[model samples]
Target: MGKGTPAFGKHNNKLVHVVCRRCGKRSYHQRKKRCASCGFGRTASRRVYAWNKRT
Candidate 1:
């Protein structure tokens, strides 16, 4: 079976959140890499900052 998606929560301690351009799902990762769900990588990914929060 394929690997399951990575978990995202306060306990995981991800450095930043990202949104997938193709799937529009939110995930936490340290670098501007590929989207886990849709396999969209590089320029297709975008950073996500929490509301009223700054990074």
Candidate 2:
């Protein structure tokens, strides 16, 4: 129950897992929006695109 630790049973606020574009390695990041492994910021991360499908 320390600071930054994921909560138990569905209340977890852990750092999100993301892949670094520059280093191609997986890392954990929070609102700071930077890769801990390579020091790459959010701009160097992968882009996410959402598509809307019409029924």
Candidate 3:
């Protein structure tokens, strides 16, 4: 019955996020080449919105 449980645990070594070079946060996607924290590869500016202001 639990077919998904065993399948998901087998591929746990996949490295998806890494330490971002700009913000130094662990949100950089390896395959996408884009930092989820600071928008390193996608855009020149940080990946943020006006409503989601940090302080």
Clashing pairs in 3: none
* Candidate 2 displacement at residue 43 in angstroms: 12
Please give the lDDT score at residue 4 for candidate 1.
57
Best by lDDT: 3
What lDDT does each candidate get? 0.56, 0.61, 0.88
Clashing residue pairs in candidate 2 (N, C-alpha, C atoms within 3 angstroms): none
Question: After superposition, which runs of candidate 2 have C-alpha atoms over 4 Å from their true positions?
Answer: 1-15, 28-30, 42-55
| TM-score per candidate | 0.37, 0.42, 0.74
The digit string of per-residue lDDT tens for model 3 on 1-55 reads 5655656766858889999999899989999999998899999987888878877
- Model 2 scores worst on lDDT over the 10 consecutive residues at 46-55
Query: How should the candidates be ordered by lDDT, best one leading?
Result: 3, 2, 1
Q: Kindly report the root-mean-square deviation of model 1 from the true structure over all alpha carbons.
A: 12.5
* Stretch of 10 with least lDDT, candidate 1: 43-52
Q: How far is candidate 2 from the true structure (C-alpha RMSD, Å)?
A: 11.0
Q: Model 2, range 1-55, lDDT digits (tens) per residue? A: 6767574666645547577666777763656677766667755554433443344
lDDT per residue as tens, model 1, 1-55: 3675555345656556576556777753338576655556644444343663664
